[model samples]
Target: MLPREKYIQISLEINLFYQRIMKEHMLLIETHLPSVETALITEADSLKISMEQILSETVILANGNISEESIESHSIVTPFTLPCEEITSKLTGATINTNITMAELKLEAGTPSCTPWLEMEIDDINRRTLNLLDVIISYKKKLMEWVLNCKVFLMIYPEMLEHLIREARLYKRILNCLLDRKLPEFTLCEELDFWNNIMGEHAEFIDGMLDPTEKDLKEKARGFIARFERLVEECIKTAEKLIIQESLVATEDLRDYEIDATIGLLECKIRSVIPPILADHVLREAYHYILILNHK
Candidate 1:
């Protein structure tokens, strides 16, 4: 079984990062829908608000409960997060919870021990997160089905909907393992396969969303797509430490690319339908994958 302190730290850190990501996913869906699709748009908005509320709770819980490593990982909130959110909210005319981001920025690492009260709070947060994941996962699937069946037209791709669902499912699995007081059961190769594929899909989305005139950026995105595809193949073939090292290098490169892209988007130097927050979103995920690969 995992130690109580470790569990509490991991749970809060995970929620702090992923709850924000999931809410941004909802924001993307909400913004991409046509004005005529009021019902779907409203549902997406409500879901986004729910996720933001949960994230706010997580920020409060995590203030002094998480590790210093997580704070330094740049996976929870990048330097770009605040500026990106500010710009994106203004551009999209959407209400983003910069307050939560501000709170997260103030979080300090605590002693490596969990009090009984803290443990109870972590348990409650975990339960709430799991329930929220269920709703969002089902909603993502519904959107996927609707898009596939041509019942609705969304500016977002069907594959993107599937990608969001996969992320939520991964978060669900991690939270469940925490709730069970056990470590996650994934092997190195399994972890590589999951995150490498996610990285590849992110590259694909960036490529597809970029303006046709931005040939250089598009080509760069395609290169990342191919690179991650090859990494995934290696993951399927072997679980060697070499693969982990190689993945780390590739992920670092990708993270740099994401950072540049995010900067470009924030500075109005990139042409795309991709929001600045989405750019920062993918950048954070790449950084998260890098941390996982390094730990492996």
Candidate 2:
């Protein structure tokens, strides 16, 4: 039987094996995630349109002698308030028809104006205003969600992927070396439980993206990526420990070669795998659906 260090070394090798699986998983997820910056920009543009609609409603309400009571009760958003004032000022002096002018005067004088034309216009404003307000409120909630999603995307993907890519190259080096030696003594246990666990996690991430019941892919993926990142960190630590411990048995110059070779292997692996993974249909579908939802 091999010495305990050799067994521990095998266990470490097994750990590195699973680390590569996780990197691939992360790559798949990164590939599938929607362009968050684009999504946020789209939402911001929609919110801007909603704000404009609210302002337009305000103008109609003011011009048509909408009651002070209605404006006070419904004008919860600040942007609508100043525009109401501006519309009143513009209508007070502008030469429209006599009826509309009287309605404007009556509105400024704080009396209810009841001309049917004015009343219908005011009614339309009320309906549209209420609807626009609801949209603005919903947009505010979405803004909060977007803030969180953007933070996760910014913090996680660049650093986490880079680490995983680096660690994976290192593992490939060790794998290649072990393979070259034709060492049959080192066997990953039959189950390859660690690899299975990572694949399970990958499946769950994909399921979240695909499940019709899931409301927001970015939100779900954000959580999964954060959790997966923690797991990757632990796996990288284990891999690095193995590399350091193993290097203690080698000459200084040889140790440097091992480290460089491992890094080079991971870089090569990432180049070969990532672009094709990103092009996969599952990832493309996720991006498509997310864009559709954002536009809606």
Candidate 3:
């Protein structure tokens, strides 16, 4: 691969890591949002307008795409603590209004919150879901910009660079829908298996790169390359399987994502990077040793 391509591959791998973290954040948000929404949907039966208002505000925070300023001005997230059962028992049934300003509440020994509490609910789930879709779509623009101009593509190793670039292409296409809530079970299972296999192969790649060349270490390098190729072949097969099963598996799981289908993805990229870096390390040592010997 050319220098430019190699550099780009590295950048792609880095960006892929970024994408993986974003997925983790999404998973965390989803973990709580659904149940919170379910509870609100059940309890907020009589206050439709109030509930809807709260839902809209929560959805904005839940999506987590807007600026803090935008959210703050709109009070996208409420901050308040409800009275414990002990305190509530003293007051019978007191209703809290949404209009209460958060700053005014005195948070002392007993009071827990400054403003009224808001709950996320299902009536506005569609909005949040659609917002997620938009975020994923927006990611494409970022991916394109990185793919086209990332510094990693500037590396000298053209062959390796090209390989990484091609893989990034596959990765980018798959990224489109990886965040969808309604994921396919079987396909996710298959992708995870494939991702694990790739990780194993990548580990070997790292070992091969870091290893000092013995009397026959070049032979080992060749063997390692063969194994790497086999792993790639397996990955290709897995990719094909996804395509055959569903026309858009890539849209759901990037070649680099660490979802159920793409877990261990970062480790593999790290592994892939190690080999060349190791080789360079050894090469530098060889050049220094040769100079010393010649001087002697």
lDDT of 1 by residue, 93-145 (tens): 88898998888888899874568988988899899989988999998899898
Instruction: Write candidate 2's Cα lDDT for 1-296 as tens digits.
Output: 43333332332223222222332333333233456656644553454344344334334344323334332321121112233223323433311122222232333313334445544443344344335434544543444454466653432333333433433443344434433432333222211223223322433433333335333533443454454344444444455444333222222222233233224323342121222222122222222222222222
TM-scores for candidates 1 onward, in order? 0.97, 0.24, 0.24
Worst 10 residues of 1 by lDDT: 233-242
lDDT of 3 by residue, 1-296 (tens): 22322222222222222222223222222222234344422332223233333333433323322233322321112121112211222332223332322321221112111121211122233334334434443433333344457522221233322333333343344332232322123343344334333333433433444335322433444454464345445544555544333312321222122121112221232232232222222222222222222222
Show where candidate 3 strays beyond 4 Å.
1-155, 182-218, 228-296
Q: Score each candidate by Cα lDDT.
A: 0.90, 0.34, 0.30
lDDT of 2 at 232: 41
Q: Provide the lowest-lDDT 10-residue window in model 2.
A: 72-81
Write down the lDDT that model 3 would get. Answer: 0.30
Enumerate residue pairs that collide in model 1. none
TM-score of 1: 0.97
Runs off by more than 4 Å, candidate 1: none
Give the CA lDDT, 0 to 100, for residue 33 in model 1: 89
Indicate whether candidate 1 or candidate 2 has the larger TM-score: 1
For residue 247, model 3's alpha carbon misses the true position, in angstroms, by 25
